[model samples]
Target: MATSPTPALPLPADRPLLGIAFMLAAGLLFTLLDTGVKWLTQSYSPVQIVWARYTGHMLVLGAYLLMLGWPRCRAIMTSVESLPGQFLRGLLLLGASTFAFLAFRELPLLQVYVINFSTPLLVTLLAIPLLKERVTLARGLAVATGFVGVIIAIGPVDWRAQPAALLPFGMAFCFSLYQLATRRFGRNDHPLASLFYAGLAGALASSIIVPFFWSPIAMGDIPLFLVVGTLGAASQLGLIMAMRCAPASLVSPFLYLQIVWATISGYLVFGDVPLIETYLGAVLIVGAGIYLATRRG
Candidate 1:
């Protein structure tokens, strides 16, 4: 009797160094995208900015799909493991984007990034309930520490007096929920399909309301709009490549580099500088995030 043929081994083990590079690239691209959004917010509504972002994302993603040929494109289009979950994930990202745009309008980019860095801590807390994941006491303290950092960064301001200050927190919360949703429902879905649905949902939702908030696009700003979408798509693709090349644990910490990128970009483009509190608070938040990521990894 002929023996059964051996199954082919999966792709060679991940190249962690390369993954780190990809992660860094993704982070930089993301910072650029945010910079563009902040710049556009000077003249556009958040709704309009968000619509341009998602629309550009769809346009770029469509070109990518076409390059992969019709068969692969067809597969990506048909493969939806969970439509509702995908839709929810899309809306969460859209909400996060909206909040980020709003926050950028009201706060400096570095401050916005510092507040958003609390996302990992929020994700840990969210996981206990939504993902039914266990958390040790040490992790709990880290989460608390991260929050303390957020409070410090925000300073002792009355909430009702500065409602706009809350935008980044909303951004962090929505992003954390999006992360949890990806953990729950994305495992079995096609990567490209998931990417497609995310942009599709955002594009559709934003398109419906964008008309009401519309402003005529200046010819000079056309390139900026395209750049926003291109950067968004490129950054996402970089993230996907990073995950494929290395375990999340190996590359996750590199995400903190975004703080550096944001700080530098904020200074160069917008002439914003971080306060002493922002630095101190960033240390705590970044430290806590690194600790949690390493432990989980």
Candidate 2:
């Protein structure tokens, strides 16, 4: 006997608890993935880590689509015009991940996460120009408040003293571009198709440079590579499941939990504790984000 196809997504009201669980799982998986990336820097090149991440993501997604059968596979192929957009989105994501990885090499996990949280603010701002979105006064205030939090997190004007401090900000900018592209494509393609393009594009981008940075993986480190790759795909799937189960507003706030996870992990793994200013800024950033995610238009 053949297995029945998967059921349609349940309404958010029907499964709020499950949605919250999925979001929590996604956050934990993502934080663990980042921790693994930071750990692997001790031995592997950033290029190699990035390559493994995208390659594994693509492979896992492909296998999933295959299991879902032909219609889903066709959905992922998308249209010819969308190809360039997908490729650009992939490049932006690659840049975002690569820069964050580089920042992790120098910065503590808490600091990197604090800066990375600014992507929502940047995304709202970028949408005005790129997506022709109208910014409500409330949204604008939230965005402004978020930037203030970012400044506090960044500390003094002399932050250029630690140039690497800027990498996570750069990562946030690139990630916003990637999200914009995803928004553009959302109008025309399936989410899985867009995800397929992201994984494909990211893998291709890193594959170009991975050759130069390649090292034979020690037997001991193979599991690390596998963990990073699996977590990348699993975390993405978890986020998708979360949104499928509940409204984005409900699921998104859970993402802020990453800061707590990052803080704890950073202290335990790296013996790095964040400054009081970092905590203050994080509260503001998270508060602003919660407002943005839940506020009426």
Candidate 3:
């Protein structure tokens, strides 16, 4: 009998550089989205703004699916391997978005971004239990360091006076959980399908409440709403693509770039200046995050 040809080994899945690029682009887009949300918070409730974000996400996703034709669209729609997981991911993200929008209404853009940087630390800790991953001593130290950074960034806030100061931490926690869910459930799903369902829960939840919060949107503000939605959808897709291309650890550090963008945007658009503590705390947080990302067990 003829010997069978040796089977080819599968190629490694990661493309770290490409993932970093995607992450960087996503960070920029997210900054723009946050800026738009902040601006809109002046005229719209967080619920209404979130509704626009997810509704636009669905619209953009629908248009793309339609462009791929009926068969492909149907396949993507039907490709749910973990419907519950997808829904949970959507809810977690919705919670994150709600917290973030609320924080934006009360806080400076840079401060909000800095506090949310604690997400990487939260993800690292949560992964041990949720993802069943091992954590080394170095990673543990890194997490501690990042936590210190968060405290420094939050420097001397009077809780009763600045109650909204706590919102970013809530956003970070929800977002960390969302990231874990995405890592667990996203691996086997089609990218388009994952993107669709990621926004679906938020869209439905917000739609139910948005009518109550509705402010008649101005014609000029229509474009701003559209931009918020489009940017949210596009940035989310970019994050999915980044995770697909590389491990989350590698891509996670690039998210710190958003702080830079947020600082610049905060200054230019709102004439806001970041405090010295914000800069110092951001440094520690970003450094710890980078360490946690690169020093794998």
lDDT of each: 0.82, 0.79, 0.83
lDDT of 3 at 231: 92
- Cα RMSD of predicted structure 2: 5.4
Report each candidate's C-alpha RMSD, comma-separated, in the order given. Answer: 6.9, 5.4, 7.3
Error of 2 at 42 (Å): 2.1
93-147: candidate 3 lDDT, tens digit per residue: 8999999999998899999988787787898898999889888888888999989
lDDT of 2 at 231: 86
Ranking by lDDT: 3, 1, 2
Q: In model 1, which regions exceed 4 Å deviation? A: 1-12
Q: How does model 2 fare in lDDT? A: 0.79
Collision pairs in model 1: none
* C-alpha lDDT of candidate 1 relative to the true structure: 0.82
Tens-place lDDT per residue, model 2, 162-198, is 7888888888888888777766754345556666777
TM-score of each: 0.93, 0.89, 0.91
Pairs with backbone N, CA or C atoms under 3 Å apart (clashes), candidate 3: none
